[model samples]
Structure formats: structure tokens, C-alpha cells
Target: MENAYKEIEKGYLNMELLRFTTAGSVDDGKSTLIGRLLYDSKAIFEDQMEAIERASVGKGEEEVNLALLTDGLKAEREQGITIDVAYRYFATPKRKFIIADTPGHVQYTRNMVTGASTANAALILIDARNGVIEQTKRHSFIASLLQIPHLIICINKMDLVEFKQERYEEIKKEFSKFAPKLAIKDIRFLPISAKLGDNVVDKSKNTPWYEGPTLMYLLENLHIGGDNNFLDARFPVQYVVRPQSDKYHDFRGYAGRISSGVFKTGDEVKVYPSGFTSKVKGIHFGDKALKQAFPPQSVTITLEDDIDISRGDIIIKKNDTPKIEQDIDLMVCWFNERPLQIRGKYAVKHTTNDVRCMIKDIEYKIDVNSLEKDYDDKVVKMNDICRISIRTTKSLYFDPYTRNRETGSLVLIDESTNETVAAGMII
Candidate 1:
């Protein structure tokens, strides 16, 4: 009992926030599953629960509609669906979490790609009756394309299917066959009823024949320790902090978030594009100096020499540097009203780096439903994922999105309208 309190207190006091995302076909109970997690884990306050209950009553639901807890926007409430990526925050005794409830519409594939890009794991829900549909493959393909390490295929609304073991196994067999073609490492399937609160937070008595940890158990115990690259140090300077007056005129610092690995004081690092060399003099998270900084943390770095570093420039270990290339191949999910031009220019934003790029060649288009490649349809339209070659004006220093998402991904913006046209994962 004391240990439980300690764990709860520690989580309430200081818990490391872990971010994850959920993607599935529309009305697959993604929001309900999340609501069940938060509600059953005791993450919701009384007032919040009251509000949810009140909203559910207003919506003419007999019981509190758990999906109402997440569908907070007016459009989503009216439509009874999620439109964009809705970010929800909650905490448990084990971890602090942020769940991005992404849309499943074909037109909203871009939103799923965006949400999955930074997620440690992708919780993919499958309706027991629907089995593996086209949207399921599309979501799974996106998770694989984004290189999400862990995948939880929650077979939801099992009660509707009579909680049949054969049906569950059949779905498992189907998904297993398709998973080998994906680039995922860990995969698990759970038969859950988000509506009845079975095997989501609590074990389901209806499925006494099945034996496995509840969905909550997996979420709490999943190993996310190696999610970030700890060996290759890369930091992109976002801002330069310069306090120029008679008081501290000599002060010059490079401010940015560490993309990967660990950077320590006095470490020898190279400034990109310029080939200039410098040693880290100090690390500042805020006002104080730290000995080192690590991934996903924002900080300011003061170097030993003022070597003409600017925003969008990367700092890395002198020996372990990423390749700088002008021509590259990337898997892109086209998301826009306008089609991609065969040979057109775009503003490519990758991490903190941005450059002008043009389509050099169309490699192939991937069929999400069938996993087939169509080479003849070179025309890129909305929600069609295709691999293509692009040539950037300046060399982009990066790696495969599979190696490092922060350095390996790029988003294309229309040059004329300044609208985000597509999201790409470098191959």
C-alpha cells in the first residue's frame, strides 16, 4: 500500500512525459479506448468526470459516453468523429502520457502521418466485425513508414462479436500475415471492449479462455528505453542568444533542442556546412550551466569559439557526422487539394532545417489497400503515398527516417500558396 502511494506521489510530483498516438478507421473506438484508459486509471478529476457525464446526458446517452471525453471540439461532437489530431494528456502511477487521437479518413492520412512521426508507439484499433479493412492497412502502412517501433493492434468491441476466440485468432492470423511486410519490431494483439470496459483497464471476465495482460498492463510496462538515438549526437541551433550591452557584450550562445544523443561540456563538435570546429564550453537549460544535454530537451549551448553558427545549422560529434546530399529518395504521402508537379519547386522543412527542393523523378506509387506498387501513375494526388526523388538547392545533412526521425524527415510546402503539401520520410 505504501509503495503504491509512493508511486502515485512520484508520478504526480515528477513523471517523465511519454508521447504516443492512436490511429485506426473512423469509429473504431480510438477515442473510447483512450477515455477508458484515462477514466479507469484514475487520471480524470471529479469535475472533469462530471462534465463528461453531463455532456453524455445532453447527448442522450444512457451511460457516460467515454468518447465524449476526447471529442472535445464542437465539430467533432456534432459529427461524432475526430477531424484533426486531437492531443489528450493524462497521467498514471507509472507514466505521464500524451495521446494524439488521429483521424482515419482517407483525406486525413496526412494527419496520421504527422501524429505518428514523433510517437514512440502507435495504438492501432481494429473493429472485431470489420477485421482488417483498407483503412487498417493504410494506418499500419503509415506506422511502418514512420518507423514506429511498437504497435498495439487493439481488437476493440469484442463483445459485439460474442467474444469468440476463433474470431479473435482469425483476426490475429490475418494481421500477422500482413505485419511481416511492415518495418515494425514489436507487435501485440488484444481483444478489448472499450464500451463495456473489458480488457482495456480491467481484465475481461467474458473472455476467461484468453490469457494475456490487459491493454493497460502493456502500456504501463512497454519498454520505451531505446526510442531515441543515444550514440549519434546531433543538435540543431534554433536561436542565438546574444546579450550585447556593456554588461555582457561578449556573450554569444547557440540555442536549440537536442535532436539525439548526449552532448557534454568540452565535447569536440563540428559546425555543419562551414566545416568549422569548436568545443562546447557550457550547456544552459535555462539560466544555470549543466555538464550535458540529451535528446528532446531544449537548451542553449555556448561554444569555445564564435564560429559563425546560425539557425538551421547542425552541430554533431566531429567523427560521427551525417551525410550531406543534394539528391535524395523519400517515401512521401501526398496530402493536398493540388497534385504534385512532375518537376516543381517546394520549400522542404526537415526538423529545424529548411531548403528549396524540386521533384527530380517519380519512382513508384504504393497502393495502401493491396500493398502493390503502381509505377505508371506518376501523378501524385491527395492521400496517395509514393516514393520519389527530389533535388535540393543546398545539400541536406540527414539519415534515413528509419535511423533518426528528427534528421531524416521532411515536409513540403507549396511555394506559391505557402500551404503544407505533403509529409515525407527519407528512404
Candidate 2:
């Protein structure tokens, strides 16, 4: 038992985390694929399995409905559709995973965007019978827009199509024809039957022609170490840490998560807005002092000079500073039911910075289905993706969304209701 515990602890320490989102049209086997992936990998508990089995029996299912594992909402189970985003967590010996199961309906595009915004990889399931549909294209486009590093196109429900290689090739070819238009870095195609447990967690005997790695193997082995931008160092100050203790009386540290790049001790850094320059005195992670800090690390950094740094201020390397702009162009996904009013003011939040912004102009609305720009349609409604210009009250330290996602994204909130109205990516 002690040996097993040691192995578990080692696995926990060595495992890398992977965040992925699943998207497809309604009735596609996304939930089932995740359910199968969890079940076959022994990630699900015995009690959970029993509960799922009982739910299946109560629903009069002939066999256990794997889809029930992710479709947790009553409305989702009753309507036999996903209405909102459902997140699931599981771990294997090699890696840990957080699965964002997004809704498939066209009306839930905002929900999909919210779930997929932070994902490193996107699993776009294409039903074998339907081939490449509108939703597939929409999701694929969003994945590209959001700069998801990896895209795995899973042609699900191969059992219904006799697991034919010809069908799979046809879909792959069709998708590849238009894929060049998008800016996706890595894209892979896979054939699988989510319901029958084929090519999900295990290799399937049905597909003798398919020689690619199984979905589980591909996910586990995919190289994601280089996904983050380490070239342009960006650190947004979240809080100013000033403890009122005797031992740490002189300690003044800036606490924030490293957005990108690297900051090492004695590195010359420039503070945004103020344009104040200082040297990085030390990088601390809790009680231990780190030699350097990189992307996604939440650490406190003390500087050599006492600069007036506050929340919303960014610390960047002197040579690699980002754009300081008040007027910004963005590709925004409108999330509110109320239409966007031109010249109307909205509270804009980017990183740790909060500022008010006025809509300058509606550049054009994107027809997600046809991938065309509708310049005539200035009325931005719910689920409408459009490019617009906005002028902020204060200058923002930002990079293009394609370059660094952490520093490139912002959201507009309705001041009256204090609800998020739109999500935007800086252009």
C-alpha cells in the first residue's frame, strides 16, 4: 500500500495539466466521448458508476448512457441536449485534464466562447453521417480566433457508418480545403465511435486502415510546453503586498500571475502607464525564492526601486514592451440580449485593469456560418461576432490576441446591470 501511495504521489508531482474543450452540433457524441474517456480510463468512481447505471435504468435506456456523465443539468437530460458549459476533472498517470463540455446549439455560442477561451486544445467532433456542418465550421473558426494551440477533429459515430476509411477521408479532405483560411497552428483528424469505446481510451479493431495514435495517447503525448509566449515578458500587477509586520517591515512586493515571457532576478523591468524603470530584486513563490518566474506562475516580485506601482499596472522587460493604446480595435462576441449601442459607454476589464470604454464604430459583423463580413449590419445582437473600435478612458498595455492571449483579451460589461455584455480580442 505504501509503495502504491508513493507511485501515486510521484505521478501527481510529475503530471502536466491539459485544459481542453469539446464542441459539436446537437446530438453529436461529445458527452459520450468524454464519458467513455473517463469510464475506460478508470477515472470514474464505483459509486459514480452505480449512480450512472441507476440513472440509465430509470431513463429506460437499454444500455448505460455514457452521455449522462456530462449532461448533469435536468434540462439537459430532459431535452437530450446540452444548454450550458459543463466542466469535468480527471487525471491519469501521465497527465491531468480539465474538460470543458460546451453547448452545441447555435444560441449557446456565447457559452461555447466562455468555456473555450482558456482551453489549450479544442476537440471538434464531426458526426460521420452529417459530414462537416455549420456548427463544425463555427466551432473551428472560434478555436482559431481564440488561438487554441491544438485542434483535434474527431469524426465521431463511426459505428453507424461501418467505420469506413473512405467516409473519414472525405470529411478530412472537405475540412482541409477551407482550413488554410484559419490561423490554427496544429490540426489533427481522428475517427472514433464514442458510444462503442473506439479510439477514445483504447485502440479499435474496427479501423484497420487508421494507423494514427488513439485519442488518449495523442492527448497524453502532445507537446504543449512551447504553447505559452516566453519571448515577450508581461506581468500585470494584481495587488500591492505590504505586510505590517516587524520582520518584513521593509518588504514591498507586487503580486500577480505572470502573463507571458520570463522575469529573472536583477532583470531590468519597466512599469506600464508610469514608464518607471526598476530592476527585479527577487522573485518569491510563497516562502521559497525563485530564480525566475514565467507564464502562469502566481508570485510576488520585489523591485530594486520604490516605484508607485498599483493594480492595473503591468511590469514588462525594458526591451520587450507592449503597445500602450487608448483606441483599440477588437473582434467582439456580443453576449447580452440587448443590442449594442454605438457610442455607448461600457466598463472594460482587461487583465487586472478596469476602465470605461465607448464604442467608436461597428466595423463589421461576421457571418459565422458563411465566414463573410456583413458590413451593412451595424446592429450587434446576442451571439453576433463583429469587429468594432473602442476608445478607453485610460491607456491600456496590451498585445495582439494572436501574440499573447493573456494580455490581449478584454470584456465589456453593461454598467447599468453590471453584467458582462461582450468578450473581445484585441486586434
Best by TM-score: 2
Off by over 4 Å in 2: none
> What lDDT does candidate 1 reach at residue 83?
77
Clashes of each: 0, 0
Residue-by-residue lDDT tens digits, candidate 1, 1-427 = 9998987676677656678889864488877788778877777789988998998898788987777777778988898877788888877767788898887887788889889888888998999998988888888988999898889999999999999999999999999988889999899899999888889888999999779999888887888888898888999889999988898699898999988889999999999989899999999987788999998889999899978988999999889989799999999998898999989999999878889999999999998878899999888898899999999999998878889888888999998999999998898
Candidate 1, which segments miss by more than 4 Å at Cα?
A: 1-9, 43-64, 245-247
Candidate 2 — number of clashing residue pairs? 0
Please report how far candidate 1 places residue 118 from its true position, in Å: 1.5
Give each model's whole-structure lDDT. 0.88, 0.92
Give the range of the ten consecutive residues with the poorest summed lDDT in model 1. Answer: 8-17
Candidate 2's TM-score: 0.97
